[model samples]
Target: MKFLEELQSLKEQIKRRVQFDVPEGTKNIVIGGMGGSGIVGKIFQEMYTKMPVYTSDSYDIPDFVGDGTLFIAISYSGNTEETISSLSYAKKKGAKTIGISSGGIIEKEADVFVNVPGGLQPRSAIGYMLMPLLLSFNVVSEKDVDYAYSLLKRIDENNIKDEDIAKKIWETRRIPVIYGIPGYRSVAYRWKTQFNENAKVIAYSNFFPELNHNDTMALRDTYRKNEFFFISISGGKDSRSEKRIDITKEITKTEMEEVVAEGSSQFEKMIGLVHRGDYVTYHLAKLRGVDPTDISSIEELKRRLSKE
Candidate 1:
């Protein structure tokens, strides 16, 4: 399937195939997975800020994870070694465990299982992997999910103009440095990873106020000016962040791009920014003449790891 088709699959993927409930008396949540699957956890942690949510991309469960912790293991392929290993540790630790996967030992071992649709690349199945988990937490309403689908449908229908500019910047072979505020930091990370996996290009990401203290210092190095393209994902919620972006632009004056999000609510802003970035990454992939869906380098690394 084409990358866009996989992204569009979210229209049908929101229907949950397996159902699970968080146990009562759970005090905290810990999510474990790796790579594309792992990103779902990170996004969730950012979106559901009311609770103590931690994401682990490593092989072992964190020391803080225990019986009171609700551990969610997410692996679209159902066989990510790090996630499986973490799930095993969670079970041994007596944490309440839920597994989200297509199918694998995780499904068999989890106290409860969520079956996401198979066939699409894990990253491309963001809605499938993320929506169900968010629903479980009650952080995302059905209306929110519906709105996201409708928003994507509109974007698909209305040609994205940002694609042309993004293609031009990407074709220059300059490294992409994505920045955003607290509300849109995850979106920036998503853009960076999308470029990494889809465009097969190296990209970096950081949040505002924090980046101002250290990363802004790099602007003094004029030799690196032409080597980087600065892209900011602005949620447009904070005056401080807006000022920071303005200052950064004034300081560097490099080839900069801003993906300003429009929405009345934080959730809407986040999904909107993510939707835009996804399309930009697709265009970047097209300009590079690479299959956006293919991540052979990651597969090769996994193969090497399996042999070790």
Candidate 2:
């Protein structure tokens, strides 16, 4: 299926899927996965700040994880070694565990199981993975899901414009360095990964305030400007972050291009920016004459690792 068609199907899947309840007395939440499966937790961690939410991409679970922790193991294929290892460790530590996948060992072992649809690329199934996870914690309402669906539908309608702009920005040889304010860091990171996986290009991401302290200084060297294409993603309400973004733009005026996200709510901005970036990566793939859906290197790495 086409990427846009897969995205369009996401909300309908969410609407039909069953919801799980967060266990009572849960104090902390830890999500374990990698690649597309892992990024969902980072997005949630940014949105839900009242309690501690950690995303573990490594094999080892944090020392603080215990019975009070609600550990979520997410792997679309149900066989990601790192997430499975972390989930096993979490279970041994007596943490309440929920597993999200189509079918795998996690489905059998987890205290609660969330079954997402199989077949689509894990990255393309973000809505399927994210909405159910958020709904379980009551972080998002059904109305919010409906609103997001509407927004995505609108984005689909205007995707040609987004694609035209993306085609213009295609730089087959230059590395893409994406930057965002703290609030839009995850979105920027998503864009970076899309370029990496979809366009088969090297990309990197960093956030503001922190980047201003260190990375901003590197932009002074005009020698490297032609080698990199900088893209700054801005969608923050914080005055300090906003100011830093503005100043950083001035500092890198000759080196970087800017893209601002638009939306009234945090969810809208996050998903909206992601929707646009997805198209950009798609167009970038077209410009480079590469198949956007192919990830041969990753598959090769997985095959090699499986032998060990």
Candidate 3:
């Protein structure tokens, strides 16, 4: 319920204005973090296309991430080890470092610290995690943001379509394969993780043009064909990608659930689609008789890693 309720706070989260100045001579951007925190970078990369933006999930900084690079570390907990390690690497390379977190070691280590609200699960804080990037980059216009927020604010938290999708996925008892177009690739990944963590089920995601070439062939394996469920997310205005999705469906002849993204702008469409998946995962957890908030396996892995 807490996670579900937090979805409504996205309007407030986007209202946060960040004060960040791009350093003189900064040529590129590298965002470092893992899981939920890192996912924001993926979303930002799609939104901000002015320059090259790279997202790193591992401990090592890329060799080119030096001098003119601006490194931003995002860790909702402020204590994620890999982010700290990457931050250290960026510093050694003479890159300017900024960290966004509720408060943790990153607060002290980063040259610039952005403190967001804490206490909620990292996955549940997407709005808080995403605001810093969105506000700083100005990739989205103020008018578009306001329009998107207004649209999102009016969403029915208990959407019946989302509930029906969840029920269909839960009843299928098959591994889910979610596909997205170029624009919605991050959303597909988010849905996969939501199912893995929230629904406690194995889920996979891939994008259209690329997957149509390779992954679609995997569907031909008759032995395992019936063991998977496919879902396609549609919304991006790319006509070529849309045709690819349609052709893939016809060629594969595999049953796929289509989820149309709702909203006027790209920002709103992405947020609304992600919100839809969040509710679907919540309902799926209920149907699966699992606690959506439970992430004991991840916690256990973190605990064991801390000991090493």
Candidate 4:
């Protein structure tokens, strides 16, 4: 959390550059990529206004895409086969296309291209991926930056002892399942993936009303008494799903522990909760007694897939 906390200001320094036109006259939007890069599109779709955004990780373009569509080819490394394949397909169809990468093959193919600074591992650059998209679409506001910063300040003020929280959450050596409302679902997802890649642990997440209606019934499935449960909640009491969250808390008492995220806006709350998750995962890596800075498995997987 401390390391990621340090990057909050760096994230606030949002920058944008003129790339390309919106396919002459496109309306609907489709973002194509995979893994961590695809998550960027999903984050944009969730938070961005007006535009109907869809993210595709497969080779096929969304059926609705056409000349009036804005297709974004997002590959952090610029060389993902699926994203490249989709980029080509979108371009050949004459859809308005924008390419996002660290200067890969997709950069050469895009009509409007953004080559963000490369060299950092793609997963480590999620903020760059998200910020560029927000800047590109002009979706971000001063409020977003201020909100995130305030949340970070609040969390730091609490003086959350990382080692203590780490011990409590990652004790069982099993998996941590995170739950939250739709507004904070991405944070939950981030936590799960962070554990998967960083802590080398399996994790899961679910949202409010959806979980309230169905998942609440399995409170005592007898399979997870000792398993770790994490709940990520919005700091805003008046957030969209606040009512559903209240109901969730009223019901599930002994099952999972709650980690409150401090922020006044959805954007702040989401990032704030994510800050805690990142810290938790990072510390867990250390507690598991593993080095916090290595990911040989991901590189080897990429190598193996490339060989095939």
Candidate 5:
């Protein structure tokens, strides 16, 4: 699927609810994935607070992942080496495993498997990777999905602002430094990775209060003013962090583009912000004159690894 089409499919994807019968007595939740598929866990970590959520993008499962753990392995292609290896490790530890993917070894190996729709790139299948987790854990309600779908549909129809933001970033020709405040930390990281893979550009991300301690110095001392394009994502929940974000922009004398999330629910706000970033990435790709769907470098890396 093309980038735009896959991105637009989120509205439809949200309507397709996934049902999982989570094992009783499941106490801890551990998710394993890599790259695009791995991001679902990061986003989930931010939304789910009742339990210990561990997101692993490595070849081995965490030492704490044993019986009574609900281990979810997510790989868009169902073939990611790290995810597959981690799934094996989790199974040995007697964790109840649920695998999510289009189709591959994961389907056969997992204690239970969910076959998400195929043909889209892992990054583009954000809805598919995310919806299952949200629904299974009851993290988001139907109303939240409805609101998010409505917001995304509206954005898809009118994205002139997102295009303008892309143009501004493209004009700088500098690495993007995305900052998220409090609730939107994972969203900021998602924006950074989207810029990296979809825009084919290097991007960085850090959350507020933490970045203030160290990275703020680089704005005035180490890096030139034009070395980075700064963007701040506002969650609107933390007044102190929001004040810090405002102060950081002012003190550094840096021009930072900001995206403030809007919605009644946190889930709606998160999905809306994510969709906005997707549009920005698409427009940036066009400005760069590159194929948004092409990830040849990643493919080549996989090919070389397969040889070994």
Candidate 6:
């Protein structure tokens, strides 16, 4: 519970700590990473898939990547083997590269870099990976990453403060079920992963309209009022699915403590709401007293599976 308070304070802590510049001539960006680092690319996929943004977890670069490509090698620990190998591959391919990490191998020789100060788990540092990604694009004007930052800046979650809500929802051991609209699916997934990695707890998510038919039936089977129902709201001005999500949350108030998303624009509000969830889940990790920075179990599993 105390950790939630710490995480809420952390958003401001790292917000200004890691700002940087995107060099000119940067085009066709490619992010190399996996697991937690890779989620940054997935969020970008959902948000800015329009650009030539590619996320590779392997050692090889895509054929389309070349000197014109802006390669971003991200490995929070500064020693991710796959990412290091990929960056080496990217460099050989003549891509302009940058390293995003907490001063790992990627940072050692990256053309440009932004360091994350989080001691929490890599998965919990999604905001750090996320915000920096947005800033890089906004710096180069490829995406409205700056618009997203401004949206995050304007976020007013005072009504949904993590302290009051954390005491009620995440203080105990309860699996969280994150709900969001179609457009905000990425945000929902972020919440789920933060709960799992940082909070070190089980969590799940389902989108609106689609969940109405399937997830609604299993709602009662979830088996506890202790679990929190996070509602990631995206004001869908161009789509009706967002409104469906709002209604779904209203109808399901009987199931759990609901935290709604808030923002003026869809992109702004979606990212803003996600930021709060990020803080909440990371604190949840701390409340449970996990390092939030380690994932040895995941690494072991990956290692075991790779042999197969």
**What C-alpha lDDT does candidate 1 achieve relative to the native structure?**
0.81
Q: How large an RMSD does model 6 have? A: 5.5
**TM-score of candidate 1 relative to the true fold:** 0.94
Clashing pairs in 4: 1-279
Q: Give candidate 6's whole-model lDDT.
A: 0.66
lDDT of 2 by residue, 1-308 (tens): 87657656654654655668888888999999899888888888888877799999999999999989999999988899899999999999999999989898889888999998888888888877787676766776666666767777787777776676566567336788888777688888988999999988888999877887787677766767677777777775667766776777687664456676666667767777787788878878888888888888998998899898
Full ranking by TM-score: 5, 3, 1, 2, 4, 6
Give the alpha carbon lDDT tens digit for every residue of 107-210 in model 4.
88988887776666566566666776775566656677677766656655553554466787666565677786666776777777777776787788887768
Residue 88 of model 6: what lDDT? 87
Listed in order, each prediction's TM-score against the native is: 0.94, 0.93, 0.96, 0.85, 0.97, 0.67
lDDT of each candidate versus the true structure? 0.81, 0.80, 0.85, 0.70, 0.89, 0.66
Q: Which residue pairs clash within candidate 1?
A: none
Q: What is the lDDT of residue 264 in candidate 5?
A: 81
Collision pairs in model 3: none
The TM-score, computed over Cα atoms with residue i paired to residue i, of candidate 6 is 0.67
**187-250, model 1: which lDDT tens digit per residue?**
8898899889988888899988798788877765687778888888887857888888887788
Model 5: lDDT to the true structure: 0.89
lDDT per residue for candidate 5 within 1-308, as digits (tens), equals 66788999988988888869989999999999988999999999999988999999899887898899999999999999889999999999999999999999899899999989999999989898899889988988989988888998999999998999899888978788889887788889999989988899999999888898988897766546687888888866667877888898788777788888878888888889888889988999999998888889999998899788
Q: Tens digit of lDDT per residue, candidate 6, span 110-207? A: 77877876575566566677677665555223233455565555443442465455455554545677776666776777777777776677778777
lDDT score, candidate 5, position 30: 95
TM-score of 4: 0.85
Model 3 TM: 0.96
Provide the clash count, candidate 5: 0
lDDT of 1 at 127: 69
